[model samples]
Target: MTDNENLKTTPLDSLHRELGGKMVPFAGYAMPVQYPAGILKEHAQTRTQAGLFDVSHMGQARLTGADPATAFETLVPGDIAGLGAGRMRYTMFTNEAGGILDDLMATNMGDHLFLVVNAACKEADFAHIESGLGDRARLEILTDRALLALQGPAAATVLARFAFAAATMPFMSAAEMDIGGISCLVTRSGYTGEDGYEISIPAAEAEKIARLLLAEVEVAPVGLGARDSLRLEAGLCLYGSDIDTQTTPVEAGLTWAIGKRRREEGGFPGADVIIGQIRGGVSRKRVGILPEGRAPARAHTEITDADGSVIGEVTSGGFGPTIERPIAMGYVAVGSSLPGTRVNLVVRGKALPGAVVRMPFVEQRYYRG
Candidate 1:
């Protein structure tokens, strides 16, 4: 058997198979890449209704100490200390050179901090946190948990029937709750641009909760393929694809994540370099692209100027199910990052007309209250 054949399986592996899911290797785990409904339908379903995703492969960890906020601030640039209890903040794990190691979500669960990181980079993220915080904080990896995301315009309505507490939770907030008598940590946040919630429950109870959520008329099981296209349409970055260790937050258009206090206080790793970029600007920036033809521009496709000179490359590209056209995102020179700047995408050795456009080819439907 290949090394990937020996990959781990989530608690819902058998359930996925029972649902006619097509399984594939992802982040050292065998996960459902798509269901029989296919990526196109699944993508549209999520935009119109609710879609349930098994994101248990993600890493969940906790940091505890006399003052966990102080320990966390040493590594990340987010305003953790100012974040109220039961609130979540999106932040980045930055290197000393201002490059991003990973992008993650941090939630204050009153006594300790709850963190969810990318599945592929969990080991590096954990080691980095441990070495930086050391004796000041204790790191606990919760490998026994399973994560599920219910996302769409009707997500809140569907989840409201199962858990009353979820109905009251505000955006970017979280709380400990029981779903069908199983204890779980529920957060009003997700990777999709739409308003959604991520529920972290016991591994053994994962299937039960998933089945319950799927039982709802508006909910369907969506897989990785649709998940990627949905996030791309929302203009969210995919780790390793859109942003990586070589990309800085400023270059990725995530400068708003660095709070004013954190930027001026200058205590976190990479503060100098990142702050410098905030003032001096970076060489290139991540922008959205609208291709001319119906043919989708896949990743690594060359981006060129009006005169057909190579300027940059596409990082994430595909057919947008919602827009019904080809769209993409990539890093281009700072001077060519304007919304109306004309550009060309070299596809099959031909330069196709394109233009720099505002991101989120589809409008975001986040529930803000």
Candidate 2:
């Protein structure tokens, strides 16, 4: 556990406090859990309008070399070599045993590849990259920057007011643009599964950019609480909870992230194991779980079958504000992973009826074009 006194603060820390954000320790940083509007209201605000988030705690870095993409592919299973310029791909680093190390975003920025890693795993992730690549690419950690996410249905309109071109960028594409007169690397992507952009800005100007976005009528200052619920409703994985070093991509329902070429011609770490799983299938698979009652199943909640047999456990669970019901994601025996398969959640040592269901409890509203 990170000591509260040693926790770091983001560039938008002051603004968060000014907006009555309730700060809490997260990933070794003092991040806001929610604002005065509360989690429920904030969650609705993002779905209906727009929500601004401070994601500066995430690690940002640049990898540059003669052929960074080809070199990068040596570490992740994603098709980094095939990633087009200004396009982004979501991929993960795996261990020798095929367990996920951490998931990350790799953006092909023309001359170099830009990476955004989870805050909790940055230090070790960077070291792993350096050791694995071994001078094949130069890693430049961008410590003097901040990341902001403007998410929701109205996010495009809110951002368009400052940079009209940003509103037209295709989903998963990135570009260098000026927003409110500050230079930023804007990507039409977000964790909420909404039409939004993740803006990377200079640390010193982060507050200015944040304030400008918040000044918009449809924009509200959101915190980590709503962010979690939003991603959950979207059926996205939360690194430490939904996925971990003990979980493989195949088991986590992320086999889609492994590029076809990489799958056929394996070379990256754990390729042998992951490819084998892809071919033969795995014993367990991640699936969406919808508890029948209002009682929300939480992480580590024991999951059982109708016959009172333990099958798996919930990895992430909560009451989805948008769905207005209890939803969860967990790994179950492959036979029980089918949608509509009846299951039981052992909450408080009592059996609670639930069933397997298709995910994305809320429709992903990304603007594909």
Candidate 3:
């Protein structure tokens, strides 16, 4: 537990405490790391049932302009101009050298673009977006908003009870709806690689909405610890850890998020460098790792070859409860990145044998169509 004196508290701060949440400092907020249910059980509950996560600390904003999509494309490589109404695109703000500033979700909200950025990077992200696209549009941060994610196989079943239309939303879709008469902007997506919805509601109504979802037997209140394990198992990147100002999309295994048109036309930031990487290939790449035995490898662990010479380092690693194995993700030499390629992770001065494996150690259950 960090000094809570200067930390920011979310709208449901008290509610979380009452629920027996082990509060900790995360991204400048006093947030729950796990609850009385514990991280292991909470994580298992999410995979088998549903998990409710309070993501209000994340930055939400709207960009309005004569043509928001066209104006916004200048900052990212994604084809925002092609983003359809009610559709969401995962993209990043690349620097002039093609390094990722931050990864974000941009939803086409017809009149404007609604965006969600990482909590830790929100301030810088907002400032960058403003400097890059402000002249072309109006950037308004949603300070009064609270975001909630309900994810798992039973997510739709529970959300549908509040808003029937929620059950019909396909993956990567967003809509403005009234869930149990509570106004919200819902997105049929999640970081857990599970079929779920992210609901953005008024800050004043956050507690009310969270209470409603927790009241359902299918849903359990999940904390940051479980959220981290769940996302890692899904092979999702965490900003500042897996990616940063020094990492490009090509090196991060996120080139897929860069649209085909953007790659061909070469317009966004660092177009020359990124496009070159797309065609010429990168020296190293982000890869999934599976360490043998029970000891879990953690971030910053050195990766080495058969000869014990250093090659790369683990970015995120831990025991994945869903897969019941020690799962990890890291950047390794391209040749050493193939699945089954033997590698070693230096943990606590001891080199642990491991191998490069396909991502999503636990198979993803994202809803399609």
Candidate 4:
């Protein structure tokens, strides 16, 4: 176990303690796993109202240079050059073997492309970006900023109270705005599968802005535990678990993230292998698994066929509070990947009944408008 003394703290660390949050080490940062409200209530709060998340641990950086987008396109599969100013796209950094290094959000910030990378992989990801782009793009790691997520059905309504422009921002759009007198870069996107905004604020002002948002009636402080459950129910991929150095985007069910132009042109790393997988198909693919019983199938739980042949293992799983059932996701053979395909989840030497199902066990309520 990681020692708490060695862990880093977010700008909202003191505030989390004041709210009785149980701080746990996550990606080297001391993040709140749950508050006095607990994970269940936090989950419900975000689903029904707004949950403020201190996601300051996430890595924020900027890529700037002449034709940075086109230069960046050489590293990832996404259509970076086509990303209009203020628009963001979900993408991944793939290795030469066509496996994901890290999943990230890239936004064309007009002058430079802003990137938000997974905290655990941020160091290596930035290094990879710097090595790949060389002089073509200048990487500026934003150490002075902190990120906060305001998520749920009432996110827009709550955020609008501070930044009126947030109410009208379309999904996947970003803008520089002032919220309650603090400058921030706000993006209408989140991992929770809800209409929300991710605000990038100066580290010095994060706690103040967080307090301002939490003071509202509809907003509450949410910890990481609920955030994980929320994203799991949304069927979103967790970087290291659901995808890794060996999982290709095609096999991970993220082929759509690879732009059509990149597919046809074939310039990015491992383009040959990924494009081939696109046309010829892969041996195994990621799929949603619904266990029949209330007992949740957890990570590394063996998935088997009727005859008890091991097919795959669950990568992410747990009780989904919103759906009020045990939900999971993992990779299985193509033959067993379809929805409604009966399977078994081996837990503690017992084979539990399950079935392959389509993802987003709960509908994603992203504010597309």
Candidate 5:
């Protein structure tokens, strides 16, 4: 639905163009899909070294109230009340039908809950949140901020220069710190399933911070292409692609995001159906698919059994530069969702041999330490 003719640009837009970024329309923004180094090199670099991503298009906001957690938990089925200060949790805003409106990260910043939602759904998401919790909470959209993600194995090493304790910060934790002399909120989490930081700084200083991060020996400026590949290899679901209004957390392999308290209290929207699914299970589930040979299976590719019966369809698929092979994830009937289950991905006209495999085709290098 994004119109290519008139798309919003991020703080790093000019810088990205200067670096030879292949500009494209993404989530209504003029974003970079790749640089001259290409998607393959960017993917490999991020897996082995570090890659910087401009993610300012993502929605950032703060919820402040007498009890922000309780107010926010009305829409999301997560234990917001149980989150400790400076901790973060991945949760989804579920609709009354037990479907996801949007998936987001909520950080308990002591005084309030800091939330970041998907770029494509921000306007609708904020409106939904505001209409529901307006009386109980004050929503302040951080429009002046720019978000940057520094991800990969070498991420912490590069960021530690500005904030030494960054190397020690546990995954899914956030802190207000100064990076390269700029005041920012740094979260020791990212989409790539690696040790990293998502920094939120003033929009005016975004390009400056990005340049500083890229100046590091191990860091390279990556684009949306590598970001998608990295997250796909991590087995993370894409907002509209793998999950959406029709998909529930249980169906999308995100049951872990629904906390015990929320599940037991049953106050959130769609609790009736979601809780039922938690107890009874779903008919189909999101699973990993590994295609044999060099041909990469793409999104919407039909997943079929050996007998040519359609089982599911590919959601996100691409070649993982780090794994050096084609990897994909899609929804399949529960009977065929188990790892090692033989399957076929109908690519173009041929049924390519594949298997329902365990997710994170590339090992998660998260720093639990």
Candidate 6:
């Protein structure tokens, strides 16, 4: 029972409570914030060993049409038609002005396009997809499905037992497989910048598969608290927090997500403005920050120059378990975005020394076959 007005529960809500998880509101879901082992240990465990995350609160859907590629292409700028079946792409739904509506992952499942979108923005994403594609594309929200993420160095080895094909899956590849007799869609991708898999399965079968995964020695249940710090350490953006309608892909350091072809032959919404920013360069760019001391600079903290003149603001910030330091990400004037540049973070009205550093705070160990 969620007391928070905006909170919803995932299929594994009861299971989390049973595991001594600290439940909290995140993206409208009453999800596990952390377990008894705590955030620091959970975050470190995921980096060195393995951690299981209940991401059932995410939105999963199927896009069907006689020409799914054409239907889907209109919604996002990614080269959907060129995507091979059983492959995944990171793309964004852009507004008319070229601002990001939401960042999403789409997998080509041969017959239909499978999509996993942010839970907080799913309603708007679905509505955009439906209204834009109309009868050309049929959007089927997979309400009966639950998603899970197993991340870290040992994730592949543990998952290989059930989904043998996953052991060979390179980054961004996906496949249809059976795990413990349950049909599922498995992708070699994660937000933690670690080698992992995102598994989508029937909601009814989630508890069973989750229990089975947890039984593995290296796989521990990680909660939202660890998830946030992990992604932050990985230098990944949180939609509404790190990025929004006010931020463009170029401004957010996501220029790579924009296709080369799309850059030249603009067609998607906001193409003109995006192309302009790409060519001329954005005034402010997202950069990583390494604080001098232990105090973690949090979101909304002011970033200033040596003279204490405010330049930008922190979007995501936390103490990195793997890096063992305070790290943050925020936009700064282009001239000051270079690595090794001296800056200061204004926290609790004190000017804390910080330096622009290369991200991710920790190296990513993705299995790039």
What's the TM-score of each model vs. the native? 0.98, 0.99, 0.99, 0.99, 0.98, 0.97
Q: How many times do residue backbones clash in model 3?
A: 0
Q: Residues 303-361, candidate 5: write the lDDT tens digits.
A: 99989999999999989888889999999999999999999999989999999999898
In angstroms, the error of model 4 at 333 is 0.4
**Candidate 2: which pairs clash?**
none
Predicted candidate 4 versus true structure: per-residue lDDT over 1-369, tens digit per residue: 557999989899999999999999999999999999999999999999999999999999999999889999988999999999999999999988999999999999999999999999999999999999999999999988999999999999988888898999999999999998988999999989889999999999999999999999999999999999999999999999999998999999999999999999979988989999999999999999999998999999999998899999899999999999999999999999989999999999999999999999989999977
Badly placed stretches (over 4 Å) of model 3 are: none
lDDT of 1 by residue, 1-369 (tens): 346568899999999999999899999998998999999999888999999999999999999989998789989989999899999999989999888999999999989999999999999999999999989999999999999999998899998898886876899999988888888999999877888999999999999999999999999999999999999999999999889988999999999898889989979888999999999999999999999889888999999998777889999999999899999999999989999999999999988899999998899877777
Shift of residue 191 alpha carbon in model 6, Å: 0.9
In the range 1-369, model 6's lDDT, one tens digit per residue, is 557666788889889999999998888889899999999999988998899999998899999989887678776778787789888899889887878899999888899999999999999999999999899989999999999999999999999999898899989989888999998889999989899999998999999999999999999999988999999988999999888999888898888887787787777888888889999999998999998999999999999999888899999998988888899999999989999999999999999999999888888889977
Task: Give the per-residue lDDT digits (tens) of candidate 2, residues 1-369.
Answer: 446688899999999989998989999999999999999999999999999999999999999999999999888999999999999999999998999999999999999999999999999999999999988999999999999999999999989989999879999999999987889999999999899999999999999999898889999999999999999999999999999999999999999999999999988889999999999999999999999999999999999998999999999999999999999999999989999999999999899999999999999999977
- lDDT (10s digit) by residue, model 3, range 1-369: 357899998998999999999999999999999999999999998999999999999999999999988888999998889988899999999999999999999999999999999999999988988888767999999999999999999999999999988998989999998976889999999988788999999999999999999999999999999999999999999999999988999999999999999999978899899999999999999999999989999999999999988889999999999899889999999989899999999999999999999998888898885
Q: Which ten residues in a row have the lowest lDDT in candidate 4?
A: 1-10
| Residue 267 local lDDT, model 5 | 91
Root-mean-square deviation of each candidate, in angstroms? 1.2, 1.1, 0.8, 0.8, 1.4, 1.4
Quote model 6's TM-score. Answer: 0.97
Give the alpha-carbon lDDT of every model: 0.92, 0.95, 0.93, 0.95, 0.93, 0.91
Q: Where does candidate 5 have its weakest 10-residue lDDT segment?
A: 1-10
Error of 3 at 18 (Å): 1.1
